[model samples]
Target: MTRRALGRRYLSAWIGFSAGGRFSQALATVILMFAFGQPTVQALVGSAGTWAVLVTLVVLGGLSLLGQRYRIEWHGVLPLSLLAFVGYCALSVLWSEYSWVALREFAATLGFIGLGLYLALGRDLVQVIRASGDAFRILLVVALGLEVLSGLVLDVPIPGFGIRGDIAYGGPIQGIGGTRNFMGFVAAMALVTFVVEFLTRSVTAWRAVASTALAVIALMLVQSPITGLAMIALAVTALALWALRHAQPRTRPVVNGVLGVFVMVVAVVAVLAHSRILAEIGAAGGSASRLALWSQLRVLIEQHPVQGWGWVGTWPSEPVVPFDVVLAPSGLPFTSALNAFVDAWLQIGLAGMLILLGTAVLAFARAWVTATTFPGVAYVWPAAVLVLLAVTSTAESYLLHGAGLMVFTAVLVIAARRRSWRGRLPR
Candidate 1:
């Protein structure tokens, strides 16, 4: 073969590897569970896991650069908003109370943003979504295997690692993610992905059925209230999108407007009846601490209302900021504000929060419109994930960190492309 032929073949292989190959899938699993020092992987690999994640991200990013076929496209203000958010985070290092910690965390967040951008720009939205689904499938399988071994074979907690048997939790299973809540989150996402694939006819019927069955079983075993509730919200969103997809184009805007109003009303009512909603979910008592934490965080935000405390990635247990000092007195240690919006305000202040929220609202609106107007299931990917993130952000601080943030960025990229495509097509 000629030299040119060999180069082309090598590029093809590299593209395949980074897109949705086994290595990519496995790497994603590691980043989601172990990269940020989840207990089980940390116990097994020590601090090496974090280094491994950094090295892998660098390698994949390098490969993406070499394998690029087209220039990276920028959609509009949405992408700019995201870049501004990251830039603001980096700038926070200068004013941060703990400059060293802020700098370190900023680097980590930047790495994730880079990884997300690489995936979004290097591949089509369908390919990227499929790649993510592939990763979730493999991760769920591995988690189930570990859960079975711990719960049935060993009947004892794994030494050093935090893998606990079903017997220990009485019923709920943690799986390999090291916590029931994390496992539930993964399982919930898996279910959504499988359903989308099935609807799109991207996967064989049997494969879809089997993967979705596994996800449902894992979700049941994990029994996380937050994940369970999030799934319900996703289901409702999916149904609404489906109806809109089937509706006439002229009627969609009206339908969407009414739905928007209804959702806002429901949200207000839920907030007003927050304690009742918590009681319905059996979390009323546990939420007292979260309410208290929110109250303390509000005071701290007032102190630095414009440009709050610097971004710390994850909140430290030792009380790094003024808010942390107040939290320390409660005798109940707090890591996150347990709310993404609150954490954003606490970390980057009001300006950062507005940028983040504005970006999200715009992205979700574009994705929803595209999904409803477009004919394929591919468009539903972004809409579904955005709904999941929005619902979960209320109780978990996953929206702006680690794997969750990465996925959020990728969805934004996809939404931007959809808008660009629509703009170019003849009316």
Candidate 2:
């Protein structure tokens, strides 16, 4: 064989070996754990560690994509709405008031998106879900362990993991997720994953039960009202999915219509009784802080209503125009608007906000439809996760960055693979 041919053969063999099932699973797990533990990393090793982790994932995922080049059918693989939103975010750099910040954030956004795409395209849906399940279990345990050592054993907050030594107080514990709300969010995702794994018989019954118990404990310890509400939404979605999956095909249409109407009515009722509900649930104080922050954001959003300040994924430490206009509870610049939609408007503008809404809504619709029609339990993962994300996003900007953004992109791709129309055309 020619020298070039010999080199190509060796490279192909290496790719095949590296992208094999076991290696892919490990990659997915590491990526997920790294994404979820961003705050812990930032606390321990600072920005250098964060950048190193990102670079490693980018390199690993990029090579995996190259190795699986032919396996991922590239016909309408990505949803158009998603592309429009991300593209707009990138385009914002041109008119961004802080061009440097915008460029840096745009790069970070692509890095995470690439990691997500690798998981969705390089690994099957079941494999990705399983990896997520495994990663969450490990992280949740670590969170609890750290909390125990900090809150109970040492009687002091662990600065690195952000455990506020509140576990002894029955928590509001941060865990490896960096905050109570984040920890709760991770637990909620873990619960969904565990349920699906059980339904699919992918894990033993005892194992599923144990994982579910761990997630529930973490949720309780975190004491986050945002997660409380999300769990409620998750339960409702689970019930709806179960009903639809069990219903006869002929009657499914009627059932779906009725469920849709029911959901609308419930939403209206919830909005109307929000005040009473908040007071009863002890979320009024948190809600008030959020409202004040949003009011501040609204003023900022008004300045450049057409195309707001710009895209900076995380707020800058130094006081800047929009990013530092408001302060976090810690007296530093607030990182997010605490609501994904409002944050989108603040960073990208009304047009970008609308595209983002379209992307999320379209993704949910596709996932919901697939869950209803597909026989496998795996189809429900995307829909259940989207519901959880939507609910939590009402109070926290979890959907915008870190693990949330990565998972969002992955689910979007998985749902689009089967539901998007562009895939029907010749590639």
Candidate 3:
């Protein structure tokens, strides 16, 4: 190969390594190291990691475009997904409460979309997910060790370590997103990745250690309603998938049934343990506030129902439409709409809704096509994870914000682009 070709190959390998879900998970833990105590600071600084990753993506994309020669010849669903996103952006501009803020947020979203497409076209998706899984497991070990030391130093209880909080410190090496929701998401990914690794390979002491640590983190997330519930749901789905792959000839149905039962039992237990999450929703006083906000969106939709709100607002206090005070906790200057679906409605109206819906269809399409074709690939599970994030988004706003949205958008791109690279790329 020419020098240029050699350079491209090396870059491709680097991107592939970074693309893994496990690597992302480790990166997430490092970001979490920064986020733990100061929620606000965590939100701000945590984004730097994603921003850095995006920069890397852009650089690789530029390289690919410049005689880099990367191509993906799959069905055209990716194009449809891209078109829906663009349509949402246009409609958002037409119907937004704050066009400028909406535009900025939409721009970031577009950036993620670009990165996803780049990954799909430029490198091996399976390798990315596998590497990510490995990195994630390693990081879980570190997180567990940190939890133990921190608990001991601080005299606060740490679950697996059987120690109290003393050693925990906030910085880039530790915390990523401060709240339980974000942490829960990370823990869920870690646990699922560990399980997948175990099924695919052999169980080692490290896997056991990581699994225990992840469980502790998961328990702590019971309070984060969106994260906790979404993860539990996703985990159950993953277990089912695992069983489908590894089930005995006669026991396949039995395993599937048992997985279903497990989901039900855990769900009931989660609800019982974290009734506060439900209480908070109930306290929101029903749909009155949401309806009031929807009224403004309704008008925009009538004008262009196909593309309702058109990227309109991101400022905390700004409302895309008029909403009752009931929409948020009283006296707080501002809070997110706390619903990605509502945010989509307010931003693009009906057109935006179509785009949102289309994205979901595209997600399932990608996952199903991939799972059917690749069967048992490590990256397939992230598809269910994308669904989890989407569902929880209806109840929480973090996934659209600084750290949460950025990280998720990247992974979504990775999952969406998954195809068999076995023969195409030299493994």
Q: lDDT of candidate 1 vs native?
A: 0.75
lDDT of each: 0.75, 0.87, 0.52
Q: Best candidate per TM-score, number?
A: 2
lDDT of 3 by residue, 301-324 (tens): 465455554563343344434332
Instruction: Give a tens-digit lDDT track for model 1, residues 1-427.
Output: 9999999898889876665545554554444444323445556676567647566775776575454534555434136667788888877788988988788778767777766766676666666656667777877787777767887887877646456777345557776666676677778878888888888787899999999998988888886778877888887898899889889888988889988898899889988998898889777865786787888888889988988799876675455656457544457667677888899999999988998899899889889888999888888988988988887788778787766787788788888776744445454
> Per-residue lDDT of 77-185 in model 2, one digit per residue for the tens?
9888878878888888899878987887788888888888888998989998889889988988888999999989999887767678988888888998888888888
After superposition, which runs of candidate 1 have C-alpha atoms over 4 Å from their true positions?
Answer: 1-40, 69-78, 159-161, 167-170, 317-319, 322-332, 420-427
* lDDT of the structure predicted as candidate 3: 0.52
| Candidate 1 worst ten-residue window by lDDT | 29-38
- Model 1, residue 202: C-alpha shift (Å): 1.8
Q: What are the per-model C-alpha RMSD values against the true structure?
A: 4.3, 2.0, 8.3
**How would the candidate models be sorted by lDDT, starting from the highest?**
2, 1, 3
TM-scores of the candidates in the order shown: 0.87, 0.96, 0.62
- Residue 65 displacement (Å), model 2: 1.5
